[model samples]
Target: MDQHAEATGRTPDDERLVCARCGATADGPRPTWTFSMEDGRRRYFCDSCSREHLRAIEGRLDSSWW
Candidate 1:
C-alpha cells in the first residue's frame, strides 16, 4: 500500500484499518475484531503485531531465525 494513501484520507478494503505504529492492514471493523484495553483504551493489531514478523527488516540483528 502507498503511504500517501492514508494521508489522502483513503480507507482500505472493507473498512480496513492501518496500524498507526506500523503500516500493516488491521482487523476488519465488522464482526468487531477490535479488543479493548484494561484502561478503557480501544486498539487494534495487525500482521505487524510483533517485531519478529518483519520481512525486509533493518536496524537490527540478522533475525532470520524468526
Candidate 2:
C-alpha cells in the first residue's frame, strides 16, 4: 500500500478514494490528486479530472464552481 493510503487507514483495494468532482473511483495504486481543504476535509480526484480542473484547484475554487 502507498503512504497516503496507509496514513489514511485505507487499503488500495478499498474504494474510499473517489474523485469529488467527476465521481471517478481510485481503484489503482493511488489517486491522481488529493486536496486538503480549509475545513480539514480531504478530497480526491482522478488524473483526467485533476488536469481539467488544475487551475481551479490551485486557485482554491470549489469543485462546484467548475
- Each model's total of backbone clashes: 0, 0
- In model 1, the worst 10-residue window by lDDT is 30-39
lDDT of 1 by residue, 1-66 (tens): 454334321254455665433556644443322222322333333444434444423332222233
Error of 1 at 47 (Å): 2.4
Q: Candidate 2: deviation at residue 51, Å?
A: 0.5
Residue pairs with colliding backbones in model 2 are none
lDDT per residue as tens, model 2, 7-43: 4433456646666666666545463566545345555
The TM-score that candidate 2 achieves is 0.59
- TM-score per model over all chains: 0.30, 0.59
lDDT per model vs. reference: 0.39, 0.62
C-alpha RMSD for every candidate: 9.9, 6.1
